[model samples]
Structures are given as C-alpha cells and as structure tokens.
Target: MLEPSIDALQEKINSKYTLVTLSAMRARQMSETKNPLVDHPFSHKYVGMALEEILAEKLTIADGQKKDSE
Candidate 1:
C-alpha cells in the first residue's frame, strides 16, 4: 500500500501526464543545450526532484516524530 502522500503524488502525476511529455521535451532540449526549469534531463530531473523533495520532507517528518518521542 502506498502512503497517502505518495498516492497523492501518483495521482498528481497521472493527472499531469501531458506535463510529463512537456517535461520530457524540455529535458531533451536541456540535454541538447539549456533550459531554466531543468538543467539536466527534464523527465529524469522532474521525477528525481519530486522524489528528492518527498524524501527530504519525510526525513523532516521523521525527525519531528523522534523529537516528540524524546
């Protein structure tokens, strides 16, 4: 089972599949030259950034839980 936020993220992604295509185009453009939203491959960068942000947020949440436990 997916966590609620992760599920929400997936929904956001499913709803924005068109954006994903655009992002892929942007990524390809970046690979060929440059793009402001993403400096690296757009598709990979988009997913990577989303995952990274989620991980970081989860870490913060975990730290909060630890502090509360202490």
Candidate 2:
C-alpha cells in the first residue's frame, strides 16, 4: 500500500497531473537543496517526502499556478 495513499493526496491536489508535476518538481528541489518542509519527513526519498508534505498540508497550490510551502 502507498504510505500516503492516493485518496489522501487527492484531497490536497484535485488533478492527478498537477499532483505528479508538483511532486516531481518538489522532489527535484529537495534533492538539490537537501532541505524538507516537514520537520520529520516520513520517507527518505525525495518523492515520498514530497508526498508526505502534501498530505500534511505543509505544501499547497496557491491561485492555481503558484506553489506555496513552509
């Protein structure tokens, strides 16, 4: 089972494409910066950490195109 289930993530991002894109972009940023929004990320992999951030509501899409997070 996916740790942060798809259903749970869907609540944060309505579109799957947006979700994937956001996750991928965030993951790349995380890999390069080695910094995560969540104090304690559930997964070591950047992608998983990104998903966790989404589930925790620490990350969000603002005004459709903007991305915001702690």
Candidate 3:
C-alpha cells in the first residue's frame, strides 16, 4: 500500500491531472538537485519523495493564471 494514500493526496491537489503534473515536475526537480523535502526513509524514489512533500503541505500549486502570466 502507498504510505500516503491517493485519497489523501487528492485532497491536497484538486484533480488527478494536477496531482500527476505536480508530482512529476517536483520529482524531476528533486532528482536533478538530489534534495528531499521530507526527512523520510521509506522512499528512495523522487516521485515518492515528491508525494510525501505534497502530503506534508510543503509543496503547493500556484494559481494557473498567475503561473501563466509569469
């Protein structure tokens, strides 16, 4: 079973598409930088670390309009 359940993650991210996008992007950043937001030992994968960061509310999505404007 996934440590941070999908349902819990969905609550943090409004849609499945957004969740996937955010996790993948964050995971890639982590992989490049070799950084883990959470001090978790369970996951050695960047995707897992990203999800854990999301669950812990350490990562958040900015409003789409704002992001697009930037």
Candidate 4:
C-alpha cells in the first residue's frame, strides 16, 4: 500500500506531465500503497521551479510590441 503523502503527491502532480509532475508521478509509482518512495527528500526545493521551467519551455508567450518605458 502506498503512503498517504505519496498518494497525495501523485494526485497533486499526475495531471500535468512536467518535470515536477513527473517527479511526483514517479514517486507515486514507487510508493507501495501507504509508504512514501523517498520521504520527499527534495520535494520543496525543486517541484515548483521544475514545473515552471517545464511550462516556460512548452509555452510561447509573445513579447509586448510596446516599449517598457512607454
């Protein structure tokens, strides 16, 4: 059985397949119903930043035509 924490994490990140998401997914998969895969050793330090980086790479927001000074 997987741990509650891992299950929660999987639910939190399974939808989007980004780095952070994938990390969580992997954790969930590794977890055994009620046991965390790795104690979430580095979850906080990287999850948000990793997700942001993945989104930045995938998204293509256009630059504003107007000058910042204007």
Candidate 5:
C-alpha cells in the first residue's frame, strides 16, 4: 500500500518533533470530530489520514498551531 513519506512531510514542518506533534494533534481532531481536511478517503487510521493531509498540504502547522485554527 502507498504511504506518506516522513521526509516529505518533514520538509513542510519545522522539525521532527513538530511534525510528530502536529500529526498526533490532527489525528486526535479527526478521530474526535470525524472531520478531515482531505476530501478523498485515504486511510482508516486517523494518524495515516492526518499524514496524508499533511503531505497533500491540506493541513499545515503555523506558529506551532494548526493553520486552520484562528
């Protein structure tokens, strides 16, 4: 199965820690709200879905916060 690359996702974020934190936070949000940034179905697991969203640039981190956040 195809998977999102950690290297590529890392390039979009500041650091490895930030990427991990962002993905975890996004996965939690997705699991709690059942809302996803990406329209197409990718993965059943929230973490994988979050990673896919991050790789696609649908989700982004800004100032240590999710870009979708105000």
Candidate 6:
C-alpha cells in the first residue's frame, strides 16, 4: 500500500491540480536538499517523500492568490 494514499492526500488539499503542483514543487526542493521532513518515510523517492510530508501535516499551503490584470 502507498504510504500516503491519494484518498488521504485529497483531505489535505481539495484540488488534485493543486496537489500535483504542490507535490512536484516540494519534490524538487527535497531532491536538492536531500532531507526528509518526516521520520522513517516509507518511500525513498523525492515525490513520495514530499507527499508524506503533506500527509503528516509538515507541509501546507498557506493561501491562494488571484493573478492581477495585465
């Protein structure tokens, strides 16, 4: 079973698009830093690690902002 299941993840972020975007961004950072925010992560990959962080409530989206007119 996946450490951080999609169904569980959805509870953290309602939007799948936002979830994907947020995870990808965090994965990139983890790849660079090589640090695991959560202890004993089940997945070794950065993407999975990122998701775990979200599941554990270690990472979060503060707020959303609208783009201004050009």
Q: Which structure among the candidates has the greatest TM-score?
A: 2
Q: How far in Å is the alpha carbon of 11 misplaced in model 6?
A: 0.6
List per-candidate RMSD values in Å.
11.3, 4.5, 4.3, 13.0, 4.9, 5.0
* 1-70: candidate 6 lDDT, tens digit per residue: 8768899998877677877888899999988999889999989899999899988989877656331221
Best by lDDT: 2
> In each prediction, how many residue pairs overlap at the backbone (N, C-alpha, C within less than 3 A)?
1, 0, 0, 10, 0, 0
Residue pairs in collision within model 5: none
lDDT of 1 by residue, 1-70 (tens): 4223455544333334533443455445555663334233223453444333333342122333223224
Identify the runs in model 1 with alpha carbons over 4 angstroms from their true place: 1-14, 38-70
Question: For model 5, what is the alpha-carbon lDDT of residue 38?
Answer: 84
Score candidate 2 by lDDT. Answer: 0.86
lDDT of residue 11 for candidate 4: 40
CA lDDT, every prediction? 0.39, 0.86, 0.81, 0.36, 0.79, 0.83
Q: Give the range of the ten consecutive residues with the poorest summed lDDT in model 6.
A: 61-70
Could you tell me the lDDT of residue 63 within candidate 6?
55
Report residue 39 deviation for candidate 1 (angstroms): 8.7
Compose the digit string of candidate 2's lDDT tens values, residues 1-70. 8889999998788778878988999999999999999998879899999999999988777675843331
Task: Kindly list the per-residue Cα lDDT of model 5 for residues 1-70, writing each as its tens digit.
Answer: 4577767877776477877887899999988899888887568899889888888888877665644223
| Global Cα lDDT for candidate 5 | 0.79
Clashes of 5: 0
- Give the winner by lDDT: 2 or 5: 2
Candidate 4, which ten residues in sequence have the lowest lDDT sum?
53-62
Better of 2 and 3 by lDDT: 2
Best-to-worst order by lDDT is 2, 6, 3, 5, 1, 4
Model 2: residue 47 alpha-carbon error in angstroms = 0.4
